[model samples]
Target chain A: MREDRHVVSVRDIPETLDDSALIGHSLSEPETFAALFDRHADEIHRYAARRLGPELAEDVTAEVFLVAFRGRARYDRSWPDARPWLYGIATRVVSQHRRAERRRTHALSRMSVDRPATFDDRSADRVTAEQLQPRLARALTRLSAAERDLLLLVAWADLTYEDAALALGVPVGTVRSRLHRLRAKVRRALGGNDPFAEEPQHG
Target chain B: MDDEIRQFAEGRPPAPAYRPEARARARELLLAEARGGGRFRLPRFGWQAVAAFGVTVALVGGVAAALSGRPQEHLAAAAGATQSAAVAEPPAGDLEPRPGQFILVESDTMYGSMTMGRNGEESRHLYRTHRKIWQSVDGSADGLLLIEGREPRPWPGQRELPKDAEGRQSSLWTTLAACPGAPHRSDYTYLSTLPTDPAALRERLYTAADEKDVDRDERAFGAAGDLVRETYLPKAQRDALFEAVKGIPGTQVAEGVEDSAGRKGVALGRTAGGTLTQLIFDPATHMFLGERQTVVDERAGQAPEGSVVALTAQLKVSVADRLPDEAATAEPGGGCPSSAVPPTEQPTPAATLSPPENVTEGPEPAVTGTMTATPAAPPAVKRSPSESAPAVPESGVAATETVPAPPVAPTETAPEPAAPGAGS
Candidate 1:
């Protein structure tokens, strides 16, 4: 009865709380999820933007947070990290704009673009994404939607296989099977196992 | 993962930064939602102010679940939220009957009830009766209750029919009376004069129905069901009434259900203590077809599980100027006309009967084939105790009842484990 009496808002929540803790507390104070949004929104927005372009990304980002907040009650709290769950939600939201996603991939594959792939922490490798992106984009368009979601979460969102499973609400084995199917298709399309060789930029 | 694919996924497209405007607009939407935002699509008729408020309350509570793609979890939360809000409001969803002359609602009702006799024995009985009530829009009316008990049949093998067998009555029409304290002193005038504003009507009805001080929402829902079924209402008023009932704490809406008569409709339900009552309505027309009540948990004065405690199939509900031609005359008694009831079968003393099973009766199975198969052989459809249908197969008409069980009562049930059909 006490639980039914009041629904809490964000102001009552402490900033120091962890995501799962924030989610649990948000049950009483639904606004407490604002803290969760502030913690994870940037990364999810970047992921959506990369997949569906900037315009749809904004809508997808907002949808992800709202959906996560609404379904917080069903979230499994035993897991300490909320990122995987948020990414799972973002994956579903991004899924709705499938036409827009395919358009982005097809558009990218047609271009002869050049850009340095200096992912901040992996800078010592000193490789570029320009040479491989076009072919990779074509390969991505050929893969299944479920495969694409899994590969992108790991490769783009930087989630581990286990986290991807948690996000997708599937077992790690299923994630591995999707991964295997994706890589096999890419190999067939690219005509080689190591088609994405990161040639050292000899500057 | 392939490096090219990794770079493809890790690849950043040059897009603008996360805009503060999007974030701000989203927050505004969220806050508005939290504060119960959104305007109701106002209806053209009825009390505008109350209707708007009612619609707003309904939308703010109902819209989120509609929007959520994963409804399994969110719908429950929304229902919980709506129930608490409903409890705070005054009772609602009452309708005012049509204006002018006595609106005669003539119905053929097949009611199944549990009967307990002074012999410390309990039996379930189902009876069919033609109930006609001629009421002026205000509440004053005459009712004719024609129950065929036991009589000399015009043909062979039709003698001494069961109490609940379908039969026409020729008894006199008698004055109808309301239950004690029904709608502001059971006055027809008060019922017709009720405000169409759902909230106000609900509030007023809730107070009257809550006299026992227990199962408030259930009682209020019952009262609402009564008004909606027993009286006639216009379309707009009827819609307002359902919307009002939707606001009650335990009102559950079950879409795509079929009533016992095989007519499809939406079922609105509420459960109190251990009894679940459902009033089915034709969704397209919003007409009340029938209602069923089930005894959910084991409690005193309740029958076994899966027993349909009460069922009423409204054979027909039409507006007529007077009682049907055959049931027109009234005897001297203020109650039911004696001539209207069959003369041979004695009226079972009302005091010995359970509140529900006090209808009509006699002795012979008009169509009896004594067949004894598994009494609990599952019916063609699956049913929760709350969902109902004919309790027992109407005896001999079908091959299903292979054993020699007489078709006295139409009610069938999951047989009590020990008692193989009580050898009456």
Candidate 2:
């Protein structure tokens, strides 16, 4: 009976089958979690890589999915979108390697010290407000782990406060509060206000 | 601000490189464990036993605060019994403050964490945070928060304190009274108006947007914790909150919890998010003592086993007629200010209880950190294999390769995850 049905990859599962359905499917067929994996791995991996590094990013991304898979039995079917849940797992996974991430950030800043974004990627330099790449990396490193996570999730991961709350297991209010705090910190770190702020340039 | 950061981070030299090998390795390990049937099962019994023992001590503290001989049963009631009757009557016969006044709670919180600095230097440390809140019981929804931090005894890699222009250690005092971003007036009154009947309360809280999905009992308990922490409620409602909380499954009385001011009290412990959150109470008077969150199941959390993630112990909770100290500066209440804050996020016990129904899936693909919103286990659905197994292994290796066809097929439309779509 088991052999009669072919094992389908995650993509084959209908895109319409939101996260909860796939999770439900995974309950019967453990491999079904892979579909959930395929949907979000790239983003999760990117987030992790940005926080930590490519090496740990892969491991952290893998761990996030693995942990999610192992814990699928407890996943709330109520949350059809798995991004918050996956990111939450990814956060925990990243939190475990805090030192490594800090080191990597420092390394990145150091790596960029000689040739700022101005040298390597002119486009990136324009977008980042022309601050030396090291300064941006340093600013990130200057933040607490909690602040960094919130900032990057919003900045890099592009999660809203509500999604961040769901992912972090805190309340939307708390997310708002953290983001408010983070913005202040960012302003302070970047010599007052966002370096790439969009106000019209002065004469 | 976020856009700039995103742009800046993206502009850096190399884009995120996905690792096929790492994913493969993790996949292999998971598949092996999934098929192995008895791979790694997180050992919960050890923590539960410790929690039970610790709870006994905390409950004794609660009993003392309650000045009641009946807390042992209340303690037992917390063990997932769903004591519907307890909703009408708290286990302890404690007195409540007279209505129409301010209730001031002052306490110190200890947060232990491992810090990784910008230069990649990492170390473990402990810091103490102090808090004072003056919440009015009357419907105006007025409140005050005076929070500050004191450097704790140093551990390795602990950093120095950062102060404000006034030479004050990092401090925040916010006043609340129907201010836009301040405490919600409805949050208080809405919670007050909930049905007092335990079962009905469970239905009301659980059927709400996000609450509907998670384990009903835990969500209810978490919600109760939120209401208890955030605002000052009338005695009847307070009792109702506890009664509702007591009915949630998996709650047991933590015997004794010493408040930050070193006062003894009773506590209720619920484990989630890889940490055991103990809602401490005044043992003799049944008043709230701040809570203590300890890492119980570190396998999935940010800390190691037994680490004290954060704990708040209340020093003073008094029913006063007015703002305790109006002259003292408070953070502007209407809109959250863009002020420098101590880096750590204080865990507001009541904040966790808010409904997540308003949030919807948007174009942004990002994740926030949410520890628990576990869908209440459906009657037809099989509990996690580990939950059914009375004897979970040390590493929770119980996941098996063999599959059991779930007894019922889901007839779900597969709504967006953030759409407040009903999972059931």
Candidate 3:
């Protein structure tokens, strides 16, 4: 058992390297970049899927890694985690399909109003949230492309304000202010229900 | 801390499960770029970007070819040819354009267009367009491309027309500059200078530079298609082109293939990556019709197998004395910077020999036929494995004895340096 553990540890060494270190090594050994893909492709795909839909998520995921691999030389080595940089490229790629995004949001805003009534076991709070979906989707369609990008980068991608700002190539202050305005607008659209007023109550 | 904004995640349409094939293909493309040992340049223009999209789809189907160092040998071993024995005499044409005359080509085309949403959802459709181009014979003056968008059709499995594609029927025109040092590739004078012998022409076709990330055989096949598609080739050159295509290792014949214009014709096709590009020819007359590309294998995040991703139908090819007056009033700087005109001469204003109305009213020629014949015996050329096994009627009248030797070493011919910003 101890001998097997030693062998496993040795094999796991390359996988343990930070993105910055892996990127640095990839300059000399291009295959090392595959580690980055393996590490982040799923999360990136999920985030893109949430934004664009599954069909386009595949392309977005592929394009993000390709763009990242090609631009690895210019990757800021100081940033240990590559998530922000990857998200930044994803943001740009998603922006190119603005029309499709608008259409998606518009479609969501039109989801049937009686949908919540169909499910009996759902929690009251969950039901309320479901009902707000139409308003929320409509509100999303109204946001500027940049605002929508920052909102989704935070809400969907789970990026911090700082990381979201990095992904967007904006100062942290901009992220804060824009997010603040976006929350207020969303709150108004939800009829004064402050989405950030309380911690999320459900998983 | 998470906010109610996270609630939007619940509203997201369920994303399709990530396919491992997509991941592998993307990784391979990156590794290939890395192995190429340079900064990867994304295609810069709209059409080139579309071509790149198709290439990505093709790569998904062509993993075996991509992995091999010798793509030509692998492809040659895999490709087969079926030749029909009924030879047709080459069509007669006095296609040579006089000095100052423009070689006008009008065609209808439909190509795949993909758009991804901010949410990561994408829609695929075929964007259709009608194009009219006027090129100077000697590359001494400006050329014009008058393109009008047509209705778009959804790809297979797509239910509704993409919202963004709605109301895209707009007419736009671009000028092809004929400046010194940057000749239009299809300039008649240069095309007329090409060798008319099949063997020599085949060598020239093989020696042309490979398109970025495309294999030598694929590039040669595409070059052959480009030479005949929109440009007028005199009888000798056209005859040689058909014969030269036979020598290309992967060239296959498909019987009863219909072009975009609904004209049934015999097709000579080649597969690269995952796409099958067929250059359709009139079966009886063996006249060039047009070209179409079909997806032969399942592509990642793209059209399904058997989808016609690209299609073109040549409507007319004629000579015009001058470009329309609209060419004179077109926006400045709209012309391609790569003009073919000499530095010493000022460009003469386009002479108004005919009205624009007259130019647009030319009757469409009918080239309709039911191409049903198949030869009982294959030609004497070497054969390999092919996707289309149907035997085609012999179209080209070239002698069967002169099959050129297999493609020579790529190092033998230097790739012609591409002119900057040249439109494909």
Best by DockQ: 3
Preferred candidate (TM-score higher): 1 or 2: 1
Which DockQ value does candidate 2 get? 0.09
Query: Across the candidates, what are chain A's individual TM-scores?
Result: 0.81, 0.83, 0.80
Q: Among these predicted structures, which one has the highest TM-score?
A: 3
lDDT of 2: 0.49
Q: Residues B176-267, candidate 1: write the lDDT tens digits.
A: 53112121222233333344677865664464342232356765675576566545565455565676677788788987543433444577
lDDT of 1 by residue, A1-203 (tens): 00001122233234445678777756544455666777788888888887898788877887787677656778899987899999999999899889999998998787674554424433423333444567778888888899889988888888989999999999999988888778778777766645444443343
lDDT of 2 by residue, B1-424 (tens): 4544554555443444465655555554344323221211111110000000000000111112221122222222332232221121132222122223344555555554333233433344555555566664433345676666454534322245312112223776766542222212223333445556667655544433142334556655655655566344544565565666666678878765644434445677788767787777654445566677777766644567776656555443433434545425665442211111222532223432222222232222111121111222222111111212222112221121011111111111212122322211
Task: Please give the clash total of every predicted structure, in order.
Answer: 25, 57, 19
RMSD of 1: 27.8
- Cand. 3 TM to true fold: 0.43
Write the residue-wise lDDT of candidate 2 on A125-170 in tens digits.
Answer: 4435434455677788778888877767666676777888888888
Candidate 1 at B424: error in angstroms? 60
lDDT of 3 by residue, B1-424 (tens): 3354665655443445677767655654455344331211111110000000000000000112211122222221322211121122233324334445566666666666554343435455767676767777555577777767776777766777877667666776766655333322555655665668999788767655323334667667766776776677665676787878878888999887765555556788997657788998766545676677888876632567887777766655655546766687653222222122334654332432222323333222111121111222222111121323322323341121111111111212424333322321
